[model samples]
Target: MTEIVRARGLVKRFDGLLAVDGIDFSIREGECFGLLGPNGAGKTSTIRMITCVSPVTAGQLRVNGMDVTTDRRRIKATLGVVPQDENLDPDLSVAQNLAVYARYFDIPAAVARARSDEILELFQLTEKRDETVDNLSGGMKRRLIVARALINEPKILVLDEPTTGLDPQARHLVWRKLRKLREQGITTLLTTHYMEEAAHLCDRLVVMHLGHILAEGSPQDLIERHVGGQVLELRIESDGDHADALAALRDRADLRLEDVDEAVYAYSTDQNWDPVMRDVASFGKAARLRESTLEDVFLQLTGRGLDE
Candidate 1:
């Protein structure tokens, strides 16, 4: 696979504070790559620099073999962007919205109309073509935003929190469309707060926190490497005796333990969970265990604390 985007020591700063503190990564063509982190993790800042909407404070970034510094316009031209918020003109009709956004890319009127009709049908929004933005459902509006981005026929599609506000069914629908785009060989770079979104869409991803990459790999690879195959969470009651319970398994070198308030999370790799179950049995009915997930790896690396 070809490298579509490359960064080395990529840095972004604002008023002397470093937002993206020198990160390095590469994205492959025709694959979905994700940048995931909690708030204030520089995911958005990095995206801004990649799109050339913000200047790089230091280091090098290249998009499609073109330097971001010298080829800002060229890079922008090859990229399609879907922002986190709905920025569509509410007064415009569905078709009107795509036509107006297409103009920004300097797409000709005839070409824009043809593209809009085709994209609308592709997204199952053809029936709502002439409807005003206010009348469209939340799902329709989001699909429209994506359709507008495609008006330029970009090689790379950048989506920020694509399904943030949608319900389960709507989110699933968007995921299916994105998967179809990937099948068509479009490179996708995604920044999302939802862990499941990243897991489902990305072939690979980097977990970032405080402007640095904590880990990078496929979602399953990450889960296996960081948190192991299974997690045994032993929840203790608020007034329960945790010290005595922890002492039962303290000598076991295989368990990675985290004490979050009254909750005790024991991440283990031993697929044979009988040993861990015995300890949980010691804690009576206050304990339970289940399979670990990508979110577990994220929280393990980035922490459970809320950022602002």
Candidate 2:
């Protein structure tokens, strides 16, 4: 696949504060790429640069072989952006919203109507076409916002925290639509703190922290490389030889232990847990063994949860 977006030594600054600290990454055509991190991790700043909303302080940034610095107009023309905050026009009806946005791209009125109808059907918002934006539910509003972004039929879809504030069913519905778009060869770039969203939608992702890229790989690959195959979570108790149990587990070369607030997480590459379980039976009151996921990998690398 060809590279649709590329950055090398990218830097962003507001006065003396460095938001994106010389990061480098690339997005291939038709693949869903993600920037996974907590807020203030430069995910939004990076997206702003690519979308031509902010100037890059330094380094090279390109989209579809065009330089971001010199080709802002050309770049913006081919990109569909969904911002973190809702920006839909509340006074306009759902169909009217899409029609007005299409005019921004200089799309013909007749063609815009055809495209609007097609996109509304794609997002399952056809029934809400004539309803005013203010009358829609949160999920309906989100779907309409997404539908409006596609009014230009852009080559690359850029979403910043696409599923933020959505309920489970609504989020899942949006996820399904995004997956369908990916299958149709629309390249996607998204910024998200939702571990499951990134794991489900992104083909590759970079873990960002304090405006730096900490790790980059497929979700499963990152999990295997950082946290391992299985995780054993044991609640730490002040009484009953818990410290001794921890010390015993630490003695084993095969286990990696991470101590968070009220629990100790044991990571192991080996699938078998019988031996490890025996060592914790005496001290642990609540123990859970489960498959390691992107969340575990993030906690291991960042020393914090995604929301923190």
Q: Alpha carbon lDDT of residue 82, candidate 2? A: 95
Report the lDDT of model 2 for residue 29.
98
**Positional deviation of 181 in candidate 1, in angstroms?**
0.8
Candidate 2 structure quality by residue, lDDT tens digits, 217-262: 9998999888887898887666444566578689888888887667
What TM-score fits each model?
0.96, 0.95
lDDT for each residue of candidate 1 in 239-295, tens digit (9 for 90 to 100): 456776677767778888888887778887655778778866867777777778899
User: Candidate 2: how many backbone clashes?
Assistant: 0
Off by over 4 Å in 2: 239-241, 270-272, 283-285, 305-308
What stretches of model 1 exceed 4 Å from their correct place? none
True-structure RMSD for candidate 1: 1.4
